[model samples]
Target: MLIGDVARRSGVSARMLRHYDTLGLVRPTGRTVGGYREYSAEDVRRIFHVESLRSLGLSLKQIGRALEDPAFTPSALVSDLIRQTEKRLAREKELLERLHAIDASTPTDWQEVLRIVELVRELDSPSAARRQQAVLARPEDVPVPAVLLAGAILTEPDTHVAGALRWALARSGGDGVATLRAGAHAEDAGIRRRAVLAIAEMPEAPGALEVLTHALGDLDTTVRRHAALALGRQGVAAAVPCLVSMVVEGCNDVDAAEVLGMLSLDPGCADRITTALVDELASPTADSATRIRLAQALVELAGATGQEVLRQLAHDDDGDVALVATALVGVLKERSLEDQADGHS
Candidate 1:
């Protein structure tokens, strides 16, 4: 077959076939009297083989080796190609995300586009300071898109930078709530933790309550505690059990106690919160320290139930718990007297 006929039948351009010959990738097996390149049946088959290998992302050099080297094994090379393809896909995905973030920002001009691009680069910078500065130093005029901030908070390992990113996201007027909601359900505990922390700071953000509520059931203890505290502050009674557990476990128990106190202001929650505290104190496994923590938490509750629980705790078996409960009862009595005096005045 002539090279032209092979090109026509095989879809390999003649120009490319000549280049393949120059590279010794596929040389025509015959020549006519005019000295034009000619291809035999075997040569045309080799051309198809070269095109087939190229389709799998093989480099020309690799393809040459694959075709010529008897010892060349394709398994390793194919694995390497897979790795390379995966890396390329990752880079493309990152670029696409960056573009989406920029478009979401709705930049008004080239300068704003450049600024958004620079901010995104800074957010992904290796240096923690640079990532933090990317969020903190973002010019007031060039608002960093909420999606960018949401993405950063989900992956930021630095505590300070994460806090700053959450602050920026909260101020984005809840635009990133959906991203955060997705993060809240991520299989990665760290991502879920970051998502809940960010959402906690944005209590007023749309869907923040729902995401936090969902996070309350997370398997991660830290994620659940943060969600519980945030929910408690939002006046969601669903947090009461976790908040009480926080007190019982001595995990940020003081803050949990404070939130419980605030929750007691709602008349509906007062008895339930008091009962949870009293139950923990009454548990057979309750040690002196655990009982003492529960005793202190009771002081934060409103209505007489908490005081009655405290009064009963004042005579508890554990001397330390009894002392603490007695002190709290005195404090509650003082508070009640103060309330009475103010009313009379």
Candidate 2:
């Protein structure tokens, strides 16, 4: 086959075939009477081989080494090609995400497009300060899409930046709840924690409550605690068990106790919350510290059941528990007297 026929059949352009010949990648095996390049069957096969390697993202120089160097092993080169392909894929994916975010913003002109691009770039910057500033300094006119903020919060490692991202998402008026719902179920505990934290701030966001309720069973303790606290504040009685557990485990127990107290304001939930607390105190495995924390949490409750529990705890075996319980009892009594006075007024 001549160069023209070879180019036509192999899908390698004539110019590229000539370039390959110049580089000794696939030289013509013969010449015709007119001195044009002619390719034998084997030469055409080599052209196809080069095209195959090129499709795998191999550079011409690497292809030369791969085809001509008998001592070259493909294992390391193939691994390198895999890494390069993966990097290219990652870049493309990032570009696609940026485009999607920009499109979601529905920019009206080139200037808005540039602003969205710059904001996306800053959000992905290596500097935490730059990322934070990008979120904070975003121009009021250039509205950021909530999905973009949701994606940022899921991957943000910096506490302050994550907080700002969550705030920005919340300010978007619950638009990113679906994205956050996916993040809440992520296999990465950190991502799930971030998602739950962001969702917690958007309590009124559509589907936010459902996401929190599902996150209550998260394997990550922090995720469950945050979800529980958020749910409790929403007056969801389902959070009572986790809130009581937080008190017993001493994990943000004070906040958990406060939320539990708020939940107990519901007449329907008061007895259930009180009973859960009393059960934890009664557990044989309950250490004095756990019992003491539970005792303190009881003060947040509204009913006489909590005061009765405190009164009993005041005479308990642990002197520290007894002392704290005694003080709490007096505090509850004072609160009750104040309630009576207000009722009279």
Candidate 3:
């Protein structure tokens, strides 16, 4: 077969076949009487092989090595090709995501497009400060997509940046709550914690209450605490058990106790909250430190049940528990007296 026939049949262009010949990748077996390049059957087969390898992302140099180097092993080279292809795929995926985010912004003009691109770039910057400034300075003129903000919020490490991202997410006016709820179930504990915490800050988010309620049972204590705190503030009685547990564990127990106290104002919730606290107090496995923390939490309760618990605790065997209970009871008595005085006036 001549070069033209070889090129037509093998799908390797004539120009590339000549280039391959020049590179000694595949030389025609001989030349015809007119001195044109002539390709033998084996040469055509080699051309087809090179084209096949190129389709798999092999560079010309790598293809040369693959075809001519008898000592070359393909396993290592194939692995390298796989790695390069994966890297290219990842880059393409990132580009597609950025494009989708830009489209979601619905930019009306090139200026809006540029601004959205700039903000997206800054959100992925290596510097947390840049990421934070990007979120804080986000163009209110054009709304940032909630999905984009949620993605940044979940992975952001800086506390200030995360807060700013959450704030942006709150006003993004889209499905941020749903995005956060999905993040709440992430296998990454850090991501789950961030998701719940961000959800907590979006008070107006639809379904946020339900998501937070579900998060209250997360195996990660940080995630649970954040969810429980948020739920407690929302007046969700379901958080009572976790809040009481937080008090026993001394994990933000002060804030937990305050929220629990507020929940106790509901007549139906008051007895339930009191009972949960009493149960933790009665647990034999609870250490003296836990009992002491629980005693401190009792000060936030509003009813006679809290006072009765305090009275029982005032005689406990742990000296620190007794001491705290006695002091809290004293403070409650002082408040009662003050209330009576105001009533008289």
Superposed Cα deviation of residue 55, candidate 2 (Å): 1.3
lDDT of 3 by residue, 1-345 (tens): 888888788777999999998999999989999999998888888888988999999999999998888899999989999999999999998788778777777778898888878888888899988888888876567778777888778889999999988878877777777768889999999999999999998855888888898898899999989989988898999889889988988889999999999998898899998888888888989998898888888889878888889988889888988998999899999999999999999
lDDT of 1 by residue, 1-345 (tens): 888898899998999999999999999888999998889889988998999999999989999999999999999999999999999999998899899888888888999889888888888899999888778876666688898889888999999999899888877653888878889999999999998998898888878898999888899999999999999998999999999999999999999999999999998999889888888888999888999999899888878888888888889878898899999999988988999999999
List, residue by residue over 1-345, the lDDT tens digit for candidate 2.
898998889888999999998999999989999999999999988988898999988999999999889999999999998998899999998888888877888888998888878888888899999999989887766688888899889899999999999888877653888888999999999999999999999898888999999998889999999999999999998999999999999999999999989998888899999999888888999999999999989999987788898999899989999999999999987987998999999
Question: lDDT of each model, Cα atoms only?
Answer: 0.90, 0.90, 0.87
RMSD of each candidate relative to the true structure: 1.5, 1.3, 2.3
Predicted model with the maximum TM-score: 2
Question: Model 1: C-alpha RMSD to truth?
Answer: 1.5
- List residue ranges in candidate 1 displaced over 4 A: none
State the lDDT at 212 in candidate 2. Answer: 97
Model 1 vs. true fold: TM? 0.96
Query: Against the true structure, what is each candidate's TM-score?
Result: 0.96, 0.96, 0.91
Put the candidates in TM-score order, highest first: 2, 1, 3
Q: What pairs collide in candidate 3?
A: none
Query: Best-fitting candidate, measured by lDDT?
Result: 2
